[model samples]
Target: MFWNGSTQATIQMSTTTPLLWAAFRGAVGDQLPVILALISAGADANAVTRAGDSNALMLAVQSGSEVLVRALVEHGAEVDRAADEVTPLMLAARIGAARIVGSLLELGAAPAVRIGKYTAAEYAWHGGHDQLAELLEVCAGAPSRYDQSS
Candidate 1:
């Protein structure tokens, strides 16, 4: 915990559950409203998986739940916060969730970041997102050393 002398602050160690991770997985099975309610019930929106592998935002993005993504963003989930390996924008790109990808982009999600040996752009390309790849190129016009190097 850290106190700036005016308030309390603490970090939630990476200790998320299977159900919790699944709930954010590709937004595949998670009931958005239910999960949001869970947050109300003390669920950590930024929690990491049991494997310490991903956060709620990543799950929602990969799951392509733009609605949930927006909700998490609105609730203060960091757009670039990552678990050990995956990231929300990476997940969204991997799943070809364009809207979610765009949402993250608008929220300041980087177009390029290494994820377990692959960049977010690479993830989108491998995930069969030709459009997304093009979008990445467009979004990252005049690739920087990071974009090219990655």
Candidate 2:
């Protein structure tokens, strides 16, 4: 039981059930109805993996589903929850998910949060998403390290 010492073991176990698995998979597949049903059924919007990382919001970002992202956020997902130093916003920026990025920002995701040596803007820049980088920079209210002219 990797979750032995965690206070959320019950919730964690509940998340491991087939129903929750379906919810997670549906979220990844951008199936809004499945996610809606699971959430309405009392599924933990913030439920992490067995390792206690990567929630539905993070997965929704990876899936590039702005709808799912909005649903998760509405269900009380932490917009800034970091998974391996990368927040959902960072992941969205890296993938050039402008809609998702905007949704996260509107939900109060911090633009200045750093993942190691880079902010979300830096990650977007490194990923060759100039527009996303610029968007993140504007949200951060700070200039990006990479020259926009280049």
Candidate 3:
């Protein structure tokens, strides 16, 4: 995906069942209880689809649920997993979930990590997600200071 700076970030991402279940929670809007049940039943929080890209995080962002985002993160989803050059944050931005973006950023989601080679900023801009582009830009803009060693 590439950022084009509008509000329609284009992406090359994907997902499945366990990921589907997670995404469903967001689709229905506020179904954490069900998600929690699935998790308890052995849903692989980290399970990626056939291409190994797009996990539960992708769904959470797509669904725009901060509660679900936190639940997934707390459940041990890989905050940094990538799919076809698309990261969770990238997907979240594509969907225009500002809250999800902020939450992911706070969780340490990489701001500079690229989908293949394109950064989230590039994808956000390309996808026309101005707000997302801005958020990703800020999250990835700095070196986090801690990352720059003396």
Best by TM-score: 2
lDDT of 2 by residue, 1-150 (tens): 345565554455454644335434544554787777878888887767666566678777876678888888887778898877789898888888888899999999999998789989988998999989988997898865565764
**Lowest-sum lDDT 10-residue window in model 2:** 18-27
Worst 10 residues of 1 by lDDT: 6-15
Clashes of each: 3, 0, 22
Candidate 2: deviation at residue 8, Å? 26
| Prediction RMSDs, each to the true structure | 10.7, 6.6, 8.3
User: Clashing residue pairs, candidate 1?
Assistant: 26-62, 26-63, 27-63
TM-score of each: 0.68, 0.77, 0.72
By TM-score, the better pick of 1 and 3 is 3
Model 2 residue 100 CA deviation (Å) reads 0.8
lDDT of 1 by residue, 13-118 (tens): 2245532544554355657767677777777767665556667787666566787888777766888887867677777777888888889898888776666777
| Off by more than 4 A, model 3 | 1-19, 25-29, 50-53, 142-150
Off by over 4 Å in 2: 1-30, 145-150
